[model samples]
Target chain A: MSKYYSKEVMDRFMSPKYFGEMKDADAVGLVGNPRCGDEMEVYIKVREGKVESASFRTLGCAAAIATSDVVCEMITGKSLEEAVSITEKEMVDKLKDLPHVKVHCASLALEGVKEAVKKYEGK
Target chain B: MKKIYLDHAATTPVKESVIEEMQPFFSERFGNPSSVHRFGQEAVMAIDKARKKVAHFLGAKEREVGFTSSATEANNLSVLGAAGGGHVVTSSIEHSAVLNPCKMSSGSVTQVPVSSEGVLRVEDVLKEIRSDTTLVSVMYVNNEIGTVQPIAEIGKAIGEINKKRKKKILFHTDAVQAANYLSCDVSELSVDLLTLSGHKIYGPKGVGALYIREGVTVSPVMYGASHERGLHPGTENVPAIVGMGKAVEEIDFRKGEEVKRLRDKVIDEITSSISGVTLNGSREKRIPNNVNLAFEGVEGESLLISLDSEGIAVSTGSACASHSLSPSHVLLAIGLSDRMAHGSLRISLGNETTEEEVDHLISKLPPIIKRLREISGR
Candidate 1:
């Protein structure tokens, strides 16, 4: 594990449980720009107004990948409103703590979740 | 888990022979060269011997060499010292040591662009020369992409241009990356000033040398007791200097051919086996030890991490690994998109590299890249 990343971050990044595309995802949230070098897509499957499954595809650094994985895990089994309300602070705390410069990675993951939820509500 | 170091361009472990030469200076021979005592005289003789070795390595006179803390300081003494209050011309792909100093210069700086292969065009550099331009600083080899620039051609062209001009435009090359494999003869390259680092060439760190051609006048950047001909003023790092000199003397370019074969094997194996992989820089003009590549749809930091887990040390040019979160400026200047720049990896070989180590890297890379591409859903 790199000293630059917390153990929790490295663990999730190395073996992210919720990484990949969900072809049948009811709604998807895409956040970040490729130009910025961190692009994330969050996929959600909805069941009875709650998240049945969540997955993510991230093209970014270790912190960004870890945050995406944690966010996906956080939204699973949670109601759409609860998932949307999951804060960047909560996500960062779950990963122990990201490097100060990489705190924005949590925010990017949060924005992905919000976008996914917003898409599901609109549909 | 076998550990393999492939980040030699960043630094190399000091050679055992260099350490053996440096051991006495740290204790038994510890004396300030500036002092007038008997011990000081001994230190002076040691320094003179090391200076002579360094001078011989660069094909320069003994007096032309000046010791600095590192190549960065030597570069600063060359740029900030010679081009103060005067316009400067430099390349866009120089290491931060040269680029940052040019930025800090009081004079205006014109950065000439490079080809997509990361090779700087001599004509483009000459086109940027202005009447007020006093210095043209370029690197002998790019640290990131490993592209070797045409230093001799640039120097000769600048020399010809200086013949008809009133104020001679001084030519300088940061040869830190080239010292291990390329010739740095000051006259052959026709450079007025040059920079070299100790750690980059399997020598101890905290020591560097600059070769200032005879008749060149460079002002001191730092103010202190008159040392290094008043160009750089600081207590000499005697042990590191001795090690650096020994390292320079030990350099044998013949060894580079075998390293080049290994580098080519890595490149050929990776590129042929992996799809969507592109090599950066001019392969023919690149240094023997460097292999920089960009993996499509995969983030470089993730690849670096995965490789690190397997005990293989490498580096990336991705923005994620940088303090400023900016992708490598060299890759960008070479016409790579931001996404591609974020996927660049640099693997540098060293004298100790072997076929088994190369095979280990080759065997490990495909799966790691495939896994990253899968995670990114590309």
Candidate 2:
């Protein structure tokens, strides 16, 4: 049985959305290990104090990759301050419902936002 | 479509001869071996004959072999049955069956560390030994990393400590994976206690044996009617025990040589064809039927999925804990920096594996690793 990630999640992880980097960006941050179960990296482009462009790459379980994809969609046009507070529960909620084993992938999304906002503020 | 079975270490199909031998026990001649009736006598003689075969296989006295539900139970009886004392000595790479009981036991356990090669240094084990040390349990061969330990040498050292200190310390080994291909003679290995599971040797599950030298006293972990001389209780699975004995009888020490030849072919191909690869454990000391490796810049779960699609089966070291995605404790103890550990996979071969399957795996695997690494941009 497929325990952790669903077909939707697998598709997103296999062919991730907004997965590349940007030379012109307000913030860039990456968390997790490639050799580890999951890795999430975020790049944000801010325009007039709003997130104009957001991209991510997730080297993780199917849920982790899908959450990163959805998180990018969720954060676009939102203020950097608001984006940083995104929670894993909200991420899983966006995906309808993730498998019991992969709920932690949602938390990785939260960490990515938190770190990216930190990077954004430093600049 | 050709489907290759490379997971022999997990379990093997029951052989035809073993099945034939066990047929009568299930139907026409069914009887409790402990009963005094004619049917019971048939069961009793059969059980005794099988016991003798298993004992002869392990080069131990027939009376020393006590059959149990499984190797996991046998391991518990060995580790949890420790003489209350200083600490237990063991390797970090031991199977959870051994590690879990040791971890939960009241006796403090010092998990002797393993190098990147996954070999436990005798000196390191010796360093862990102390005046209050009650037992030293290490596997004859590692299940994940495939490393073969020097059980005899380790046992002898433990024996020397017993003589010097005039203590009753015991030496135990979980020889399940090792028993299929390795020489597991307890006398030659100088082990006071040993365990082997039936499933690992192509017999049915829930049946195994523990060899306790005539004088060694192990406190029974399970509370039941005094059975197996009070070591294990409840009705025995005569059919499975018979199968276990048959499996033991069928193991050809020469299979070790054949397995090594196949192992070299598969391992050489996979590591050579793939990039950013590392074979985990002691290369020289590993079992001939096992291979564990990590692909850098790849998630093991993802790789496993890709292989699953190709009809190839394997296991990643990390398993999801109850409601939590956690890496394997075995990998964590070996200190693989969390990430390196997740990308590891265990591919164990069986008696029926073929060179064609090895070639197919080698051809199919490199592309997947390359594609996954590239996609992840690592």
Candidate 3:
């Protein structure tokens, strides 16, 4: 296990529960850039005003992948408003904490989710 | 779960023979070489013998070899000591050990660009030399891509230029990586100074050597007693010095060919099996032990971590893994796009690398790349 990541982060990275593209995703939000070494696309399937399913695909380090996984898990089965309101701190807490250098990963995950939600509401 | 080390460019394990040779120096023969007594003389004689051995390995004279704490120091002495604030000419991809000193020097520096394959052209270096330029330092092999620089050709070109110039330009090469696979004969290469590291060559860390050709003047980087001819003034690391000498003597080019076979096998298999994998650096001019590859639509740190979990060690040029959060400068210098640079991995083999280890790596790599590409939604 890498000292750069928490055990929870490593676990999520190795076996991401919500990894892959959602074929039926109602809204998709992409954030970060490959050039910056972390790019994430968040997929959300909504039913009646609640997130029916959520998934993500990330190109990044272990922390970024884990953060994306945790963000998807956090928003699933939640109202669209609640999902968009998820804070970076809450996601970081879910991953047990990130290396100082990797804290930006949490921000990227949050941005991805917000972008997806905005796309859903606009439509 | 056997752990495999493929980061030879970072450092190598000290050979047992080198350890055995260093054993006596740490305790029984621990006297200071600078002291005047039987004990000191014993240490002195051992140092002399080690110096001669290292000098012989480099095809240089005993008096030309001066031991430093590490190759970084040796490089500092070469760039800062020789140039002494005069203009310096160097390449874009030199190790920071050489690059940083050149920047810190009072003299203006001209960093010549390299070919996209990471090979420095002799004329590019020759064209950068100014009337005030006193030193030109280039590495014999790039640590990242393992591209072999044309040190001999560049050295000869500089030598010809020196014949016409009033003040001759001194040439230097950091042979730390090339020492294992290439000829380091100073005269044959026509370099006025050279740098080498012990730890990179299966010897203990904390000992490196700088070769200064006769009549070439270099000032001391530090001040202390008249140790190392006052060029590097400090108490010598006797044991590491002895180990470095033993390691240098044990270098065999025949073993390098076997390593080349294994390296080729890994490259051929990975590139053939994986569709988006691209080899970095010049295929023909690269060293035997290096294999740098870039995988499309995948982050290198993720691949490195996945391999690490499988008991295999590797390195990446990804910004996520770097301290400065930027992709490898060497990769960028070679004209790789930022995305490509961030997706690159470096696997360096060593003397102990075997066919079994290579097979294990080959079997594990394709699946990992597939998984990462899938995760990235490729």
Candidate 2: deviation at residue B294, Å? Answer: 2.0
Among all windows of 10 consecutive residues in model 3 chain B, the one with the lowest summed lDDT is B317-326
Candidate 2 lDDT score at position B166: 73
Query: Can you give the DockQ of every candidate in the order shown?
Result: 0.71, 0.32, 0.68
lDDT of 1 by residue, A15-120 (tens): 9999989999999999998677889999999999999999999998888889999999999999989998998888888998888989998999999999998998
List model 2 lDDT by residue over B176-275, tens digit each: 8898788888878989889998888878887999999998878888788877888788887889888888988998877777778888887888888777
After TM-score superposition, the amount by which residue A30's alpha carbon in candidate 3 deviates from its true location, in angstroms, is 1.8
Best of the candidates, lDDT: 1
**Full ranking by TM-score:** 1, 3, 2
Positional deviation of B90 in candidate 1, in angstroms?
A: 0.6
Compose the digit string of candidate 1's lDDT tens values, residues B200-307. 999999999999999999999899988889877887888898899999999999989999999999999999999999999999999999999999988888888889
Clash totals in order: 0, 2, 0
Candidate order (DockQ): 1, 3, 2
Q: Taking the true A–B contacts (Cα pairs closer than 8 Å), what share appears in each candidate?
A: 0.61, 0.27, 0.64
**Which candidate would rank higher by TM-score, 1 or 3?**
1
Q: Model 1 in CAPRI terms: which quality?
A: medium
Chain B TM-score of candidate 1 stands at 0.98
lDDT of 3 by residue, B183-247 (tens): 99998899999999999899999999999999999998888989999987888889999999999
